[model samples]
Target: MSDTTNDTDAAGEGTATSDGDADRPTTSVEGAGEPAELDGLAVDEAVERVRAREPDRDPETVRAALGFVAEDGVVSRDALRESLKLTSKVLTTAETRVELAGIALDDAREAAESVPDLPTVEARLEDFAAEVAAVENRAAALGEDLQAVVDDRADPAARFAVADGLRQVDERAREVQRTADEIQFDLEAFERWLDSHAVRVRDLGEDLDALAASLDDLATAVDAIEAASTGDAVETAAGEAGGNAAADSDAGVDDPARAWFDATCSHRATGLTVADLRAELGDLRTWADREGADPVGEGGLDDLAARLDDLDGRHGALGERLDAAAEPEWTDRFGEAVAAVESDLADCAPPVDWGVVQSTVEEHRADIGSDA
Candidate 1:
């Protein structure tokens, strides 16, 4: 799972000419990730590095590490440097061929200009086009190969023994990149559709339906939560006193899915209490501990929402109880508690269902899943 982070990058960022906010596409929210540093690496080696160490890094950063370059889109700097590095000899040979082809092309063009024969001109033009297309195709192939290592690793632990830590790092980085790409695609597609399609002006029925569904789900979640939180005799037996209250959860119960969601999701402005988050986590543990329950199924959306509601409640309560007057003191206390949990969770690498977590509550949070 990831942490919450803020990004100031937006659409038409470097290309913005107008001062109006309307013309610019901007997204600002903190999500878990760091910019990847992948300069001065051979293509294969750099890609390996990305897989092994990029799990916690941002998608954009992962792309950077993959030799995607700072520029984006079809003609971007993606894999260009790495391709050159990895296939310098081949590129050198290709360049020599291209230079020779260019000389031939220029000679043919001069002859065609001087002679003005239709057949000769057509032949020369075809040859020139063929040569240019060949070189472009070669360059494209080289770039694709360089990117493959970064983006196309085998499944996790499939080659774990063979790859050691390198494959894992690459996989993590690739995943982040994929997520970023998907978000950009979805948002741009939606924007395009909305702009072009003017099917209706207003639709209250859909909104009402959504609200009704949300309320019904919320009620079910409340009931499920109450049922799950009754007690935990096993947790008590696991040492509720002395052995570290934080150390009592079952193995695989301390995943970062929810934490990542909270840290990354939208509408976050203040402190969400550690104790309350723990309470929700405690409930999650209870669900996991339930006999024959779907531990990995993640329960119904309502159950998930109940925990989220608790998270928001604690967040609101904390905001009300501690205003901006005592910022420094509260920051220190909150930081310590969070840091402690982070440090502890670091030791427990629980499996996460990232897809479910990202999409579950994401329907209501506008563009939260996308880099937008």
Candidate 2:
């Protein structure tokens, strides 16, 4: 009854549609025939009044009922105003939420952009792999060179005539070995340095210079030994002829078998000594070019030490063979003094003690009447 009365009163009060359309509702604004502007405080007060008047009805349902009037019905100004404010608030809140969502999307895009691209990451990984490969290859080459040097010992040279000449060659050989060892140490240090450094060609130049110098020294030492060995071979032939003449005059005619045995034994001893020296020198040359070309792995120093120990064992075995071959009969023909020298030489290890073998060969060359 109240609703009908309110609608009749509104129409009667000139709040009806201007066009007199039977299907559409008309605004409550007097002569303007349009919706009135809504006020926030006014809308709130109208909602509260509607809630109080209805007691049990929802304020939103009551506003919807009066705001969107039926055909030929009038819209309540307070209800229309309240509905407009409610819609504006909802649209504003939705717009704020959309803005916040947009900001979050922008932040996510920025974070994604900050990460390295796939190609860039792949390139870095490839660079690191290449560096590692180079280092490993270098280490592998070094180990191979070192092993080759340790195992090589198959070539022979001419005999030494003079002990002094032989000693000089031995000294030079030792110098070459010492320089090689120094280069090895430097290379190891360089490898360690590389562990913490980038592999730049310019940065490596200084170390390369030092290695080159060491290589030169090794070459020089090797050359000196070659010269000494050549010179000693010539002198040894002359000395053997002279020693034989002296022996024939002092001891009278010698037995042909005894002479043959002396020559054979002398030749064998000289051959062994010269071969060992030549092999070592040749191996040193082979090792020279490969220095610093490889990288060692973890515990490389310990591994190198173990390899050296193995080398020592090999040297010891070779020493035993040399000693066994340096028997009394073969050495005694040279003289008691030369025999003693030969014995001492045979008693020592190889590489480190190879000088002793050179000395023994010189003693034999000086006295042995051997054309063999």
State how far residue 218 of model 1 sits from its true place (Å).
Answer: 1.5
> What TM-score number comes out for model 1?
0.20
Give the per-residue lDDT digits (tens) of candidate 1, residues 26-116: 2221241432333334445445545555456554444443443222322112323233233334433444444454454455455445432
The 10 consecutive residues of candidate 2 with the worst lDDT sum are 153-162
Question: Cα RMSD (Å) between model 1 and the true structure?
Answer: 26.3
lDDT of each: 0.35, 0.36
Q: Provide the global lDDT of candidate 2 against the true structure.
A: 0.36
In candidate 2, the residue pairs with backbone N, CA or C atoms under 3 Å apart (3 or more residues apart, or in different chains) clash, namely: 138-293, 138-294, 138-295, 139-294, 139-295, 156-275, 161-236
Candidate 2: tens digits of C-alpha lDDT, residues 1-372? 011112333212332343544333222333443332222224345344444533676666554443332122332333332332333333333333333433433343344353333332233234333433443344334334322322211101000011112223233334433433444344344343333222322233343344335334433433333343334444566587775433223222133223333433343443343433333333322332244432455423333334334444444443344344343543455345444554655654323343455566565655544532
Instruction: Flag regions of model 2 displaced more than 4 Å.
Output: 1-299, 324-328, 334-364, 369-372
Determine which window of 10 residues in candidate 1 has minimal summed lDDT.
2-11
Candidate 2 vs. true structure, TM-score: 0.18
Error of 2 at 128 (Å): 41
